[model samples]
Target: MEHKIKNKVEEPFSFKKRLESFRYAFKGFVWLFRFEHNSRIHLFSLIAVTIAGFFFQISKEEWALLFIVCGFVFAAEAFNSSIEFLADEVSLEKRDKIGKSKDLAATGVLIAAFTALIIGLIIFVPKIISLLN
Candidate 1:
């Protein structure tokens, strides 16, 4: 006996749906900035780095790397916050497993943040050296 699998047709794109998605995303960003202290810190750092980029006149390649790393850090923070929210809902009482999971999620964001910092230093250090010489 041969089994036939049915593929559901993808829904046609709608302008309303697209707008709704953007609205939801903006809401999420606002929520994170409001509630997540770390996210706010990252936002401040992002602004400072952007201003420095302009002052230094970073090259196209440098700008690309900066933007990519910033995006990764922001994404990492959002994922971490989501996991924390889920964990809090899952259990109010302290449990080792839940604590471990939350710690791991936080560590992921820390790693992304440090990676971005290192990349920023790499890109800008030589420029600093050139200025001092």
Candidate 2:
């Protein structure tokens, strides 16, 4: 006797389905840390700041700034990844305009990352100085 296999297709999602989607979305955060280079860097930076904040007694305002900067940098990196994926999907063959647009998107992320680095340095330098004092 031979057995036959059946293939089933899932239906389109409804509002409840969409809300349920968030469960998987939250899992993306874990996958992001595992797969994304920038996410790993951001996680490392967050851990470092958290340790410093505890040990050096960072002020509330400074912690706020650190959180904001770290969030901005990570968001920019995510945006850059989205742009690259979209651009690649839209133009599988490399066109000059698409290349330029992707480069511009990357530059925006680079600017955000650099700005965050400067902010981090400004916030941490004083803490380090005080520790030495």
Candidate 3:
């Protein structure tokens, strides 16, 4: 069986429409932050990582890499959340396919977070060790 999506907003873009798009995006961001526990956790982690970057006095190259990896993790989280929302909309009832889809989306966020953590540890661990010594 095929599922049908109802709304299609594919109108040609004007400056006003573009501005409205940004407003919609900001709205979504606030909604996500308000409702999603994981988004809040990610935001807190981002704050700590930024502070650590300053304290560690990482090189410019290291700072760039840290920023990139962090961005990737955040983007993955956003995507995962979107997928979860769509999946729930598709089927509110308990279905095996819906459960697996949600799980797979969650796995994307988990993998991205783990990858960022490893990169962060690699960059900071040596700096921390040297400071200890």
Top-TM-score structure, candidate number: 1
| Residue lDDT tens for model 3, 10-79 | 4455899789889998888887788888888988988988899899887899889888888888788778
In candidate 1, list every pair of residues with a backbone clash.
Answer: none
Residues forming the 10-long window of minimal summed lDDT in candidate 2: 1-10
Among residues 3 or more apart in sequence or in different chains, the pairs in candidate 3 whose N, CA or C atoms overlap within 3 Å are none
Estimate the overall C-alpha local distance difference test score of candidate 3.
0.85
Q: Against the hidden reference, what TM-scores do the models get?
A: 0.86, 0.76, 0.86
TM-score of 2: 0.76
Higher lDDT: candidate 2 or 3? 3
In terms of lDDT, which candidate is strongest? Answer: 1
Off by over 4 Å in 2: 1-18, 27-31
Candidate 1 structure quality by residue, lDDT tens digits, 1-133: 1232222244676899889999999999998999999998999999999998998899999999999999999999999989988999999899999999999998999899998999999988888899889
What do the candidate models score in CA lDDT, each in turn? 0.90, 0.79, 0.85
lDDT score, residue 86, model 1?
93
How does model 1 fare in lDDT? 0.90
